[model samples]
Target: MEEFSVRHRRFVANYFAGKVKELRFQLAIVVAGCDKSLSTFTSGGEVSRDNHQAVLYGFSAFTNVIQTLKDAVKTVTNEQLDWSKIERLRHGSFMRNVRNAATHDGNPVISGWADGRYFVPSKIVRIDGFGKTIEIPAPAEDVRAICLDFAEDFCLLLRETLIAAGGIEHLKGSKFSIEEVEDAFANSTFIPPFAKELFAQNREKIEADLKDLKHDPIADAVKELGEVIQYCDSVKGD
Candidate 1:
């Protein structure tokens, strides 16, 4: 069997980094969706189908994030991800169960209750899977809180796992020579030869764009993790 080379390991690290970036974007979507759902419920006294669909979309996106992280870890470390080992999921597979019930099963039963002068919407998700039924409270806030906590913990877990696999050295190597980037774009099948020619014709613009593009993967991950922690803490305080 061929041994996985350092280059291969670096590639895996890069892939993991890319997925982490995607997770940040998806998490933002999840938060926005939850906020929209809550706002709709607050104004209309119930979440409309369109607003509920946004919530479902957010949940589905989260599930995809989990699967992608698992794939990244497995590909990089040659080890299967133990979801139970994740701190958030240790108590139960709440995320997966809720996602399955909400998206795969029929519409999630959205019920509300009176809290003093305020009416709070509770998302009740029932599924036979995991041998239990899960009720998410004030899903707009509750579900978002759950996802935030999970995301923070999961990001930490991924950092540790990737570090153990090998330091994410390549993640820090974001800057590439213009020639190298151009060569990649030129060779990419997605970019037609004509496009490559156009790219060449606009090399100055491309170089300027590349120069203006400042990205630090590790910094970005840390910033997102911090935001997740802040949001989780705020929810807990609430």
Candidate 2:
């Protein structure tokens, strides 16, 4: 197996950092879909559709973050990464269950609204490797709260895992910032060699425009996470 390099670790970590922001954005849409405030303007069908779509996209992004973290950590460790060993998932992991259901069949049912409460349905029950069955609750709000907690915990876990994966020293000495990395990626253009001559006249303008674009991945991630946390905390228990 090839040894992990600082650049590879950085790339994976930055990719996930950006994904966290996107996951938060999707969750925001899910929250809006369930908000009673929207009842005045939006029809039940529209709200339901929006909620379902948000959950599908959010859960899918969460799963990707988990898998990407595990894969990156495995690159640094000689032993294979084990989901069962993770402390966060020991109780019950809806992230994986939700992701599988959404990817394989269809989105989990986000219906059932009464007394200003939303009830979601999980078609398949999850069984762990140890023969223990884990049941995820169907309340849409509860699921969203759990997802927030999961995202926060996973971010910390990723930092720790990466440190353990021989990147700790590299990180300590690293000068790279998330904003700088994102900016570099934004400015990178992949023009095909065959098209180089066709667009040669506008190459200077393209390069100039790319350089003028600014990206702040960390700021965006933090803002989105804040929105999700505030929304999760504001909802009174049902």
Candidate 3:
């Protein structure tokens, strides 16, 4: 476990906070489309391919964000955070196994729709290498509830972890509000015309982060030295 300064801890906490917001936003888009499909999977209704993709992608991200945050905090000896213990509580074991399978499986692409039919029964079932079919329960309706629950729990855990690590004010700048995003998604039945706003926001944030990263004097000096070395080598060859 590596020790991190308050600054670094805050950075990591804020990073995960943003990720959670992004995940919730995306999940809302999917849930909007799958709302009916989830509550009434047995009923005949057409759930879009994109909607199914959203659920899978969102679920995978939710798992990964939790895992990364817990792992990083576990290394903080001053805080006594334990990764393994976290995974053992509150459906944590189930989440870990699912995340591992989704991340490391040989079949990289898992589908919510097959042969123009949407998956129901609230689970993703597949055959393993030994010819055994593995069923992971993930009902679409349950997915939404689970994600919201996890998000709340994650935020609380992260706040505590950061404070323990001496970050008194970390994660305060996160703009992804779970309740607001949920309400926004809930009020709409379809993917809003402006649902693409999140993508644009992400792009702008990336640009801002790049700008902040460009002020390294040592890196600039190294680049200049490399250019000079290349010029000298070219002249010598001449």
Lowest summed lDDT window (length 10), candidate 2 = 166-175
Model 2 Cα lDDT, one tens digit per residue, 108-200: 444445443354544456555576775655534444555556655555554455445542333332235444544554555775555555445
Mark the 10 consecutive residues where model 3 has the least summed lDDT: 214-223
Best by the lDDT measure: 1
Q: Rate the local accuracy (lDDT) of all candidates.
A: 0.59, 0.51, 0.49
Candidate 3 TM-score over all chains jointly = 0.48
lDDT-sorted candidate list, best first: 1, 2, 3
Clashes of 2: 0
Clashing pairs in 2: none
Against the true structure, what is each candidate's TM-score?
0.56, 0.53, 0.48
TM-score of 1: 0.56
Off by over 4 Å in 1: 1-5, 43-46, 77-80, 87-92, 96-142, 163-223, 234-238
Query: Can you write out model 3's per-residue Cα lDDT over 134-188, one digit (the tens) per residue?
Result: 7776544344454444454444555555544443333343333444444555576
Q: Compose the digit string of candidate 1's lDDT tens values, residues 1-238.
A: 2345645544554555566767767766656666666565667666556655555565566666777677667655666667667635521355545545555565443233232111226555465656677664443435566677677677767666655654444445435657877889877999878888888899998788766765555454455545555655565443
Report the candidate with higher lDDT, 2 versus 3. Answer: 2
Best by TM-score: 1
